[model samples]
Target: MAGQSLGTILGRAFRLRCPKCGGGRMFSGLLRMHDRCSECGLVYERDPGYFLGSSYVNYGFTALTLTPAYVTLHYAFGWTNTQLAFPLVGWVLVFPVFFFRYARALWLGMDVYFDPQSFEDPAESEQPEPPVR
Candidate 1:
């Protein structure tokens, strides 16, 4: 965060790349994230339930999107609640699933940005992997 801009942070996050190095991918698949960065070995989940905060990011974005869409469709388009219910409900269900990875990535990026010290280069002091649950 010292020299990295917001754009760079979001760019790396959106691309699902490692926050520190921007070289390693954060996820190996649609829903599976690597334990550590391949390029820099930065541990992705710093502690237990680390990604739980990402749910806030997901919910916040969903509300922001939903509120405006609901308002616009209801007022401007004169769409009734019934007309909007199905699509909006569907969106509420699916959008979070689709945005799951992104929300986690954004949360990680913001966390790294705000607490750079917490995410220091792992090469300096290797961290033991957490025991498999």
Candidate 2:
């Protein structure tokens, strides 16, 4: 594809860009996307209703980052869930927040990367008007 496409989007996810634009952030905070990006004016809140594509990306991220920790506990030191409780819990504790950010970022990346219009297209998109207009 002339556009960056999915795999590249995931790589950009690691870098934390708007996967589509690759020029703005994928997050504005722990659980929020700024209504738009400060740099690109990409409207994150713009009806990303089909963000489910990134659900697996976020889940895979969880599996990749956490599974190894569990494996290390089991193989390196023969730790059971009881023994690995603290470390496992500590790792698992961040799951929701991490996944939220991960999902949003990954989704944005996919949209923007494959469809630049996911970032914005001048002619087809409209600017929000002032209350008077």
Candidate 3:
């Protein structure tokens, strides 16, 4: 398959589809992900710590949004820090869970976009098996 555009990659990330095929689902349930893409057989976690980088995506998003929200609510709306505490804490706790799938998807999408050739079928890249006796 040809290399995908940025829009295509982001679209697949948002839809939680496999970055390689864009057809196989990234998650089977709310928090359950398939080991690999069913359509393309592309492994979701390339290494033991592959998805660990996804935490940066999640944390980056939360911090970027939370800071702005806190500033706006505290200054523009004259909300007290105590008043904002409960909701912001809830957001911190909840949003990551909700965004988990998208974060992983985005991580995978970025990897595929930057290294498209790495995702090609292993069988195609490897030589034929040796004949049996």
lDDT of 2 by residue, 1-133 (tens): 2467577788877776766556777666666566766675666656556666667777777778888988987999788888888877777677856677767777667666667654556655776877985
- Give lDDT tens digits, candidate 1, residues 97-130: 9999999999999988888767765564577889
- When 1 and 2 are scored with lDDT, the better candidate is 1
Candidate 1: segments with Cα more than 4 A from true spot: 1-3, 122-133
How much RMSD separates candidate 2 from the native structure?
Answer: 7.6
lDDT of 3: 0.92
Instruction: Report the C-alpha displacement of residue 24, candidate 1, in angstroms.
Output: 0.8
What are the Cα lDDT values of the candidates?
0.90, 0.69, 0.92
In candidate 3, which residue pairs clash? Answer: none
Candidate 2 lowest-lDDT run of ten: 115-124
Pick by TM-score: 1 or 3, better one: 3
Give every collision pair in model 2: 19-109, 20-112, 20-113
TM-score attained by model 3: 0.88
